[model samples]
Target: MTQTTGTAGDPPYLRIVATIRRRIADGELAPGDRVPSTRQIAAQWGVALATATKALTTLRLEGLVEARPRIGTVVAGSSPAGPAAPTAPTARRRPSPAPDTEPELTLDRIVRASVEIADAEGLAALSMRGVAARLGVAAMSTYRYVPSKEDLVLLMADAAFGEARPADAYADADVPEDWRARVEVGTRTLWGLYRKHPWLARVGSLTRPLLVPNLLVHGEWMLSALDGHGLDPTTLFDIHVLLYSHVHGLAVHLELEADAEAATGQSEDQWMDSRAPVLRELVDSGRFPTFAKVVGSFEDGYDLRLDALFDLGLRALLDGLTPVVEG
Candidate 1:
């Protein structure tokens, strides 16, 4: 039930978030308990779905709620001092960086700030001014370390890619049981990184790749695993590229989904609901008998389970490659 909180001045989403946060704090919502989802919050609080989405995002940023695939949001073990607000200013006012008591601005600081901005608002909303505000520096201060937004984005992608590596990178004798295991590790690691930093999927094309050294580390890991097989160099690298593409191609949708949400002010579930009539009409039309028959059979309808699709594609791709590698 929506509360009658007199939230006269504060934003509606923030009020909903505040209510949910209170529930978590009062032990009404235990850790691992299913917290109200965006839709549920919208219905309960009588707010727009967009408002509800922003509210859940705030709770997520605050570390009070965490989203689990297919399970909805849940309470985390503890909440930190709350993450920096993801909401970017609508007006692009250029302000001198505010001084903080911490150390001077550095490359690491610049890249981290850039990543945070891109993560929250998306790449299009990112700017030197926005990043400067984030770092408590002047609008132009970021220019000292990174020349342009494009250059800074390259650095951000590189830093994010380097954040994690396979266990074999550190171990002397430890290795996966087989080549497949090794390849699985590399593929999943790349996918996980994309999941963490959705913007990474949009970086560097295949031919005109991002010339970042850290990203090359992942390449080295994958190539090394594929080397000993009797396959020709062309086939070997081709297979490596294929595996990477499978993960990379699907990952692009992650950023796109975020961008769509921002532009439409509607969540994916909401958008799908809006398009339900057209989908139903297409099924009902007698033009495509086979299509209608297949879709009609789904009790719950087709859920676009991307994670499951990634696994499904990977297994099929590897199965097709087994002969090429073993041949």
Candidate 2:
């Protein structure tokens, strides 16, 4: 039986690179195929953009892929055309306790260790020094494996995403007859991941997308859903962005609430209770009858009301967008 050990030594980015390299070598990825972008890598790996980029850069240096202008990175023809070589004894091994107590730094070890650090303390706490401390090694030694903090983060993000296998269940679900519902399923799945790791909301920037394979699954699904809608390429891209923004913007609030609850140890209900007296006093002053009426009933609370709001907003947005997409 294989004994499962916790991730205590490896950084996530290197593992991400290794996973992708293995996929390429195993013929899962073919020549000229585009790799995940920096943002996608970050989302998938659950690390910062820096680490995901580093993982990609490592692959590039190893002659696995070439980054092309405009077209993005594509798998290099030089990438091995067969299954990856068997893992060496050292590669299959995990870190063991030592008298000096330092873990051997492999790309896998570095990335896995870094992921554990971020998962526990949050990404803000991740740094070369922090990761090195976890590995019981000098910060400079980590550079031998990851080169820089940025690359390390990129790897972390991609690896996190790679953790979730694409839903094979969706294969039959994406039927031509029910594409809208299919798109919703994909969005909600991603939203659930964000809810699990609320910190994920802060990782991917709206401006600079990190490349990772898992994230593109959502995009690919949405684009395919719009295929029969008769939208132009630009319109399809716009619709995709709009749908993404709707889900992500709402999901971001989940992260904020998580942080707020952690810092205050007070649920939104409790916080509202503390604020109620002052709010009522101001509203009852006869200057804001409208406000008084709105808060007159807190029995349902914001959480209860949020579901209605989501349904209302989604319908309104879709109502307006449906024509444009179908046109």
Candidate 3:
């Protein structure tokens, strides 16, 4: 699609803001009509994700649009100049409610609120102040419960990891007899958690792992599965780490892709499509015959499905490890 550009001298984001404002003013986008998402705005306006986000923020502040959970940004019911609505400024200026009206601030509440913010807006948008803002308390209020942003993130990761109780997955009678089956269940459970909270993948890494108790529960489950196999400690632990790394290594892309999409305003498919010329040039070079042949063999272009890759990698890992573990 052709990029929308505003007046020559205007800033890129302002141009985007003006374009959307005109659409609303001209009745093209009515109240409750969902506006283009940040990615869409980025692609259409040929601007960065930050620019698109800024344009939307401006619209929201102007009372021209409102963000609806699960619905996205939509045109506001009232005009921007109408009676002052409960916008950001209004929310910021809201008088503190009576002690009875305000809910008690607890560590759990603070962590949950922080997770919600991270989940909805991403980890980058998460801040101590933002958490407090979301919780409707003083910025310093969250500090009383959680020492700092780092500590809060650790708590959030632990809480998220706690959601899936690995031990509870297999009850007394329902436990899988085969070690491979048990490992599969454990790994898949971890994968499911990562899928739910994409940002969780970015919390820690292989070299510097998250030492939270909840995360260790999953580790315990995996280690327990291979316990009675009579394998040496080093080999067994190596196998476990390998399996865990397979899931984590692939899962890291989940958040990275989301971040890239937000920053570039291009979906994975769009990004790949834009690289078609590069791919074509590589294929035409004749130096990479095998790569070209494999790529050309696809009836349709390859789509990188992470879920499928996870399953394939898991099976292959198990297959390779079977001989080693069984012996």
Best by TM-score: 3
lDDT of 3 by residue, 78-131 (tens): 747422323332232222442533458889898987776566456775678656
Local distance difference test, candidate 1: 0.74
- Descending-TM-score candidate ranking: 3, 1, 2
What TM-score fits each model? 0.70, 0.59, 0.75
Candidate 3 Cα deviation (angstroms), residue 318 = 0.6
Error of 1 at 208 (Å): 2.1
* Local accuracy of candidate 1 as per-residue lDDT tens digits, 278-315: 99999888999999999899898778988999999999
Of 2 and 3, the candidate ahead on lDDT is 3
Off by over 4 Å in 3: 1-103
Which segments of model 1 are wrong by more than 4 Å? 1-103, 168-173
> Could you tell me which residue pairs clash in candidate 1?
96-138, 97-137, 97-138
Output the lDDT of residue 61, model 3: 66
Off by over 4 Å in 2: 1-104, 135-137, 165-167, 171-177, 304-316
Q: How would you encode candidate 2's per-residue C-alpha lDDT over 45-160 as one tens digit per residue?
A: 78775576566665775788875532345799777433233344345433233344345667888888677655533455467865664555654678877888788888886766
lDDT of each: 0.74, 0.64, 0.78
Model 3 pairs in collision: none
Supply candidate 3's per-residue lDDT for 237. Answer: 91
